[model samples]
Target chain A: MAHRALRIIAAALVGGVLSACTTEPATTGTTGKGSSDGKLVLGFAQVGAESGWRTANTKSVREAAEKAGITLKFSDAQQKQENQIKAIRTFIQQKVDVIAFSPVVESGWDTVLKEAKNAGIPVILTDRAVDSQDTSLYRTFLGSDFVKEGQEAGKWLVKEYEGTSEPVNVVELQGTTGSAPANDRKAGFADVIKGDPKFKVVASQTGDFTRAKGKEVMQAFLKSHEDIDVLYAHNDDMALGAIQAIEEAGKKPGVDIKVISVDGIKDAFVAMQEKKINVVVECNPLLGGQLMELAKKVVAGESVPRRVEVKEGVFTQDEAAAALPGRQY
Target chain B: MTPPDDTGVGGRPARAPGARQLTEHRLFWPAAVLAALLLGNVALTHDFLAVRVQNGHLYGSLIDILQFGAPLILVSLGMTLVIATRGIDLSVGSTVAIAGALACEHIATAKDPGSLPTVMSAIALAVGVAAAIGLLNGFLVARLGVQPIVATLVLMVAGRGVAQLITDGQIISVSSSAYKMIGGGYWLTLPFAVLLAAALVAVTSLVTRRTALGMLIESVGGNPVASRLVGIRAAGLLVMVYVVSAVCAAVAGLMISSNVSSADGNNAGLWIELDAILAVVIGGTALTGGRFSLGGTVLGALIIQTLSTTIYTLGVPPETTLVFKALVVIVVCLVQSPAFRARLSRRRRATAPDRAPAAGDVGARQQEVHP
Candidate 1:
């Protein structure tokens, strides 16, 4: 039994080494062939198609890469940090001109970023930022300010109920617990809403950023608190869910209980057009055209800003109607 | 069966023998525990048991518990049968995602998504495909001799990918009112999902108890080698149980998707298999397999749903919600354990010297019989 175990271990070791050898040359060969054609080769690792927003982001990146004539080698991480790291390593092995990715989470990218830096490849962060203290690891970061998004949502609600003496009891449907967007959005909204004594958040719970859970939690919220006047959902999906619950409860969503959500997805626009959702602060996923521009500048050895903030807009019912014609997500 | 033991201690009035026998029933403790939890909620939350007719339909916490618990009851019912055959279906959650995705995808791409024919075809495709996946799992475990855990684990991982591929990794939204009624509509002043679950439970009970199927499953679970020797067709029974479990999960998936009018492949029915397993265990269906109770499982599912509703009603902090749920579950499981109750009763009798020896003798006989 001991001898058999040893033999199995030996076979596994040999197989691992053989697989490594085969993968190494394949990446290098692609790099050599691409570079000989004198085209800017870029490696973009996406956070997978977990949501409609992510699918739109991936589509934008692919389309922009084609339009800009950049040889973009794309990898979908499928929402796993380890998968993102593996894709980054593959990018480094291929000696891509530049690397860009929207991270799944905020931390644990120090080692992989360092590896890319050592390979003399410039890294650009897109759509989401990392929490690494060493800013020198990446060339620049570009994404929506989630905190600002939440503050905008709060600002809209405050304006809508500006002179109301009746206290506006707001119930917040938070995103996934402890997620960066969830925490920042909650903080920013609370900070802005604290200025008004008439505005008070009655109940808050994490809906885990899914429509089903959002609906279920909203139903419970409706049962527990009968005085809720406003619903501040961290995302449009949750707002949509809350709309269903409100309708089922025989109350008008946008009129009886106003909804303000973030993420300017197409469904959110449609919901606003239907007057179910009151307001939506855009967390734009169309960063592909801008990301390609940055990649080209970096490859050409040109200096760029360390932070590029994407311009976002808030859409009310009227704005939603106008933008519904051209909404991409 | 003894006369003296039937007498109530501590100067309490002696209870009737029939009442004592009812309390000693296997399902009595679990049912009592569920009732106690509901009573606690009533004491805390005003209107906990209030039922009002809204738009000609029932609306209340009790109704919500039954409506929400319907899917779980279905999943655990299937799980009870599978566990009775000494197997588990860990892939039920994945099957749920796949079924929802298939149904939603079919409806979304259909020429007329709202038509009855379209909805019927969508349901058929989803349930049929889910059953095929279950058959694959059964083949791996029963025919190829794979461990049950490993066999189901294959689909548990791969089935999600298949679902994602089918939906193209997007939440497929549909607007089929006919399909929506299955989950979110009201029929005869009750939620349709609740009525569907009740009908399925009744059919399952009749089929299992009225025939020899339930006994054969128990025999196979008790001793597979002996069952096979006795011509029980254990492999076929195992396959049938798995297929049934998958079909139940499919129905649950349809309900979930219909409720939201969208199919989120990644999040729909996520981690539901674990909840179903917990329900089965809480219902006094041993994980080791043998005797099972469908009624007890239904009560177990309701208990879980009520606990969830209670958490939100009580306003427990979101961060500690899971911990609070685990604490309650631990207490319920401990209270349901016969061995634990027996030990506690023995210790109490030891404190009373007059009844110590007599109770000790009964305890010894119980241990002998159980062992």
Candidate 2:
């Protein structure tokens, strides 16, 4: 009895070990809102509530739809591409005015976008872009420029140590290893800092964009290299975690080790206000207003840009303190 | 005193027919593998095994292994019992996420997040809710006669959503020093998490061994029908194990979220169930059920914890990290496995049967004693 159970458990463990069993952000259109006469009906598909950024993004979309007086047919694709595809099909069947979705991945959207295109329902991509050669499938893509955000962090680092000529040892707490943000941020940071001989990325490792891993890897980094001058995390949570690690190591975070992170989550602002995080590069999640505007434009048969980038900026301790009073996420 | 295993002397009496004594030395293989892995790390970092004190707290790779491995040790400790009952609770990871989420959300919304009372209530809420989940899982598996895996799988999938609901789909960050003490803060210059895990292990060992409960659980797992016929309440035992597993996972959840001072519903305790199961297996606990070892699970968890630290200390390239980790785990599994040991010894015995005559004699005596 035990052997069989062990085998099953072992098999289950092996087969599903790597899979985080993500809750695919798949939502079927319920059309819960009152579909008022003459109000533009917009179909929006969201990625799952995987993080604070995603939740804030979802809120921005929902709230913007309400404020814009547009009827939103919202569906959540819990991180599953197939769910997003299914949600898109439902939007097409419902014949909504405009269909908008954040592509869960970079591929497998050509067919669905084509379907929406054939139905004469204009599709707008938000937050994520699909790798479709046929650009006509979607009207516009609205998202943050991750590479630019990484460069902003690097630019801040260069300016912070502008007078210093000594070689600076830096460490990185990267997001998920193969994630778009992790790759782009690392590349952009490296691209900017590469020109300066004094700036050096001493060690870099993936923190999986999680707080626990962020702290764990930071601990390991501190033990391995005691002379780390700066920590460039791909996201705020990791930076916050590294701050705790730095404090535990008996060093002031902003003083001993300058911490730079991406994602302007509220927690990052709090950390900055506390003088833990040195700088935070904002990856704005409030794209709902722009998305609503683009949806209205596409529906009215007006020309829109092929790609739209959300405006974001770098924040330091002073800005973080000023912004913490009313920051949303 | 009643022994933990039902078998008087050896744990593998009926399971294996030959060389049972050598294979049943449960702690030897895992401990040896752990030592080897540490030594391998030493080749890279000279202070791999050195212990130092900084800020009145012990700072070393070994301490890191124990401190960081505390959660896994707790989860695997509970899993050891669950696996001992011929049942598995796959919902542990979800339970962990839910626990952290609930605690963090509570503290984040509390009137005073940093207050001791607030932290205590947050912990109570998480644990209380976990106990209820365990009751549900236990009810489904024991009372309703559902397969343990299937019973727990329902929650394993839905629990994340529940956690997200609690945190309103956000990573609830709290600044509670009292709460952080459970996971990140030290007590008496040692990680409180390590001390908590050690205390739990000691209590569990005393309760399960000093009494006949351990034998009862073994008997129930060994043969459910036979144990039931002997008037043992197998259903109750099943419920107890699942509850224990859930509670242990809840504590692990607290430690994790406290360590980071935040609870990320989607990522907290993600993929931990597999790690706990792997720890239980590596500790020489059979997933099939019966005799178990808590000490082995602790060593196994530490081994896993050390394996990850080893990867970073070696400065393994990011691209090859997963493959490198997999390779080391496979090596550990191979070394711990008795079949692999027997195969190696078989080749050795065949090559020099006459030269090492005493080895053959010992093997014969072992087989004679068992058979």
Candidate 3:
């Protein structure tokens, strides 16, 4: 009994990361066993079901994989880096033909990527990327361009004010402080808006990317600055919150404030259709179909671009009615 | 000068003051800090304290503070009692999320979401689920002998997941005028949320103070073994407190979700538990348990609310807002602390004897020499 316990402890220590599946890829498609079935097996680790967009993205990936007749091994990391790392190591042990994941954060993946590289499993990044200096660790990073989304919002705002040379006093409702999306969106919007001398952001504050804080902060902005002509929110949730505050303050949101927001959620389209929100820039969450295509190409040893930006669009009030019924998120 | 009898765990240790001066009052620091923060806002924006009527309702910065802070006030009110019982309810935030998610999910799925019956049923379902969760928490701590923090932490983490499951991982938006009336409507020129919170706070104060329930709760908190020896049902008291805390959190959740006309399972009531705990601590309630003051907790909640409003009113850049709020909160806490005040008074006595009060502020320090 003592000898058995000792052996088990030794085995646990030896198994540093993954507990390798003993059955070995369900008796087919191990790639090393000469690919008996010729079916490509993909391992995917997701960044938990945190929001509408993330849920949509996960669904897209799952459905696309199913439609493409590929076997998928999916794991949810629950927005933790360690969990993602563990899942990746497990995938490596499982000897998946291709491994893909959305990194919870941008750093601390060098060790795992190196291990995957050693195992010769080509990795693909979906939805988000890692800040590794060694680019060879992953075949491609497929995601939305947040900065471009911000610019789209700003561009719409400029076009709205094109007929008049009147000074535009803008109030910004930012997302959570220090978040990548918040920083990128703010930078992108500022770059576009600064081109016009008549435009100035009069009041700016972090709404922490919630409806409650968005409304509360917007109320203060309306109170402090009575001449606010525009409201640019980093996301749709905040924009919706600010719309309530604007209405409470007896001002029409889309007309009086010319509200422009990012993230084309279903509610945003509803708000746009109701003429409460002027424009919405899409941060596409439907990356599943694209991901499956990329996964197949990488596993087939095709050389893809280092970066692939997801296709998104900018929507106006007129386009809202047509878009709302079919909106996924 | 010396402390009065029964200066329990984490007590002030000094009761020499006869309440002759305004500063001697327990509520003086919080009230003063609230005034100072509002004054700062007023200085920055000339109409910071202004209140006026618009569309047959009171509209102003003051009103907005009460309106926005109503949910926090309700949560903190319940937290005060839980702390009074030598217990903490970290699950209140999760409870908030769950309640909101339940209600929003119900309303969103209903055929006539705008109908009064639909809204009423939605509220009932939400509250019922919250109460059931409270019962579970109470059972865990009272019957199962699990530690309060550990017990509630389970819910705090899993409750959000449960909430996400209820909403199906979506930000469910509902349009119901009847549902909105709970949080967004005006009642007699006041926010319905504020009135509801006020009424609940008042009822809690009366129930705890009017009857012998308050003393029983405090006794159980002060010394559980002694309370048990004295024939007090500590388990019952424990269960009662957790349930009450959860009920308050549920109402707060309703107000928040109703106000926004939507419920976000992931973000609703996120981190509100920390704010509620802070409010209780700032209100001079000791976490080690014993005595509590509902009025003080209300003031603490108001101070926190006012501080946030003042931050926005001042437009103290987006990045520095959190840091600035933290510094102000630290100062408020330092001023409220009796130990800090005693140390400050001792330093002042060493430097300048003429500034000493005849009533003796040094009484708190005198207890330190016995150690």
lDDT of 2 by residue, B269-325 (tens): 889999999999898777878778888899899989998888777778788898998
Per-residue lDDT of A180-216 in model 1, one digit per residue for the tens?
Answer: 8899899999989999899988889888898888888
Task: Write model 2 residue lDDT over A252-320, tens digit each, in one string.
Answer: 999899999999888889889988898889999999999889988998999998889997888899888
- For candidate 2, give the docking quality class from DockQ: acceptable
| Candidate 3 CAPRI level | acceptable
Docking class of 1: acceptable
lDDT of 2 at A157: 94
Ranking by DockQ: 3, 1, 2
Error of 3 at B59 (Å): 1.2
Give me the runs in candidate 2 sitting further than 4 Å from their true place.
A1-36, B1-24, B349-354, B360-371
Clash pairs for candidate 1: A266-A329
Q: Which residue pairs clash within candidate 3?
A: none
